[model samples]
Target: MAFGDASFLSRVRGFLIPIGLALLPCAIAPAFGAAALPEEVTVVAKGSGLFNIELETTVYRPEGPGPFPIVVINHGKAPGNPRFQGRYRPAIAARFFLARGYAVVVPMRQGFSKSSGSYIVGGCNVEGNGREQANDVVAALDWATAQPWADKSRILVVGQSHGGWTTLAFGTRGYPGVKGLVDFAGGLRQENCTSWQQGLISGAGNYGAQTTVPSLWFYGDNDSYWPTPTWKSMFEQYVAGGAKARMVAFGSFASDSHTMFGSPAGAPIWQPQVQAFLQEIGLPYEPQPAFAQYAADPAPVASGFAAIDETDRLPDASPAALEGYRVFLSHQNPRAFAFSAKGGWGSGWGRGDTRARALENCTKKAPEGACQLYAVDDEVVWAVKP
Candidate 1:
């Protein structure tokens, strides 16, 4: 589901090299998670009611010449324009799957970020929208399977939120080589649609009836988008239709449980579940340490400084602060640059509001004055004492 009714919604080499200078965040992946980036691939897909369009995709593989198993990770919708959704990179998922020797393929379906075509909303038909979204998935896999690095016989589809919905819908196809499906907080909840939840449930039942493969579903009580009853009913409706599925309600997580699959902290929560499920489906589950180079770097330590942008504040700064400021502007949006009186400074980059992350990192140095936001996203808010 795209974010907020309107929307919501990588590494390199022989597949490692960057696709273009424009596709990256200043050519550096955020250090908050994994410093390693992914190579971008364009998958030609028919979507947005158009004939043929290109879908932006990211591919990460272990260091080797032989073919490896494939895992296609789907992304949810982001608010506002889908064109600005940027590339989909779940750092944690990329690392976890890579450690297990599965070459990860994260695709930006038609109409997302730099991908071609517009996103198809499909009116109030949640299921129909999912089916439409699944079309792009088919195109991506068609391309991925043809690649020399891909082990076409072993494939796994995993998604979160709207991407999760797409995974479930894709399962109904019984596509060749796809062994299993994993959905984290799947489905679309449109505020404008009356009884859309039931629509989703009914659609899930329809998919369940047609689905020949097994799937694993994850939901949490603290999700701002999905309530327990709403998703539980969707699961019940699905299994009632004969789809072999297991629903894991992980209860509450951090501030919002919906963001689990993407966060590095979430690895412990979903990894074990996924590990067992992969084994049950006759897939590889043990971690392959050789793939560790593909893993994501550690996230910045949480310092509870999330709201710094709202509060105009600053700490002492040295002459070096100016250089850090330049570095801050080069990264992706939704970022923040923080400075400390103790000459400690850091920039938080990646998705979501990282103002606090920046402040927290700066705070660790025990700045002389209160650490303050020097810049946020694209704007610099620091007050230079003349």
Candidate 2:
């Protein structure tokens, strides 16, 4: 996520200038989007009609349309240049809602990925930053709800990390057809900014005070971004603001729980809770059989070349490469470490094809040699048997 220390982990947003609150209807133009995406957002300008931005969006739908219920899924801001961040969506959550007959809309707001615009961080005013981003979300929703295949009456808004903050901020304004809100590890952290945690707490209070929609929030104890105490305090502040909400403190998952929202393995942790929430809110909760076939790709099973800790047995590896392996072992599963006989080594983990990433990185170090996968998850993957 954007607020944490930069790491080998990869996680991944467009621009709007604001002068007012009057939002013109944003035109959804899937026909004019990038060849790969086939989706675009056209000038949903808010404020003084001063500026316009085209947003890239992705929509996932189930077969057979006819006014399907819809969910708006928001994405977090990643570190570095936002222009490089790929098309992002919480695929796991999208599939969950899709299986239950909800069409999912993911929008790349402002300067993220292929969207044209600059990301406005607004300095240390994180709450304001989120509120600003919510404007783009408003535009996305305006277009999404108007779709022929969408049932605007049944809408759910969900966000993770910075998007979580945006979801709550967006809730402050009661837009049309917003039934409920869900936040996963929400907040923006600026280590360089003073009292940023307090800023988030206050921001939650600000959103809660103006929000009438009931909400569900999920924060884990092991989240690297926001700690348990801070989130718990934020929850108390929101409730104290007289907003009705429920907080689920799901202890931990993976290496960092912040990533749980996007990982398919995280389903068992949040799905049941989400299902109950949907039922309570009078939305569709039953899973559809036809969509069941669209399940998430499972992680590769381990191949026992050697116990993962057997770095000493790593064939032809140099002392430096062996040390790197020790560090790689600390990361959670769904990870891979690549190395070559020439001692070129690299590792990768997180929400992408870590094996490929690892090998690609390792290859750069082994220019004259070939890099291969040596370890994956908790097992060694040396292609040749010892």
Q: lDDT by residue for model 1 over 244-360, one digit each (tens)?
A: 778888998766788777654566789989998887766788877776565554444434433343332335445455556556656645467877544678767654326546766
User: What TM-score does prediction 1 earn?
Assistant: 0.74
Relative to the unseen true structure, what is the Cα RMSD of model 2?
10.0
Q: What is the lDDT of candidate 2?
A: 0.73
Q: List RMSD in Å for every model shown.
A: 10.3, 10.0
List candidate 2 segments past 4 Å from native: 1-50, 297-306, 309-348, 352-386
User: Can you write out model 2's per-residue Cα lDDT over 44-91, one digit (the tens) per residue?
Assistant: 333233466767777777667758888888888788888988777454
Worst-scoring 10-residue span by lDDT in model 1 = 9-18
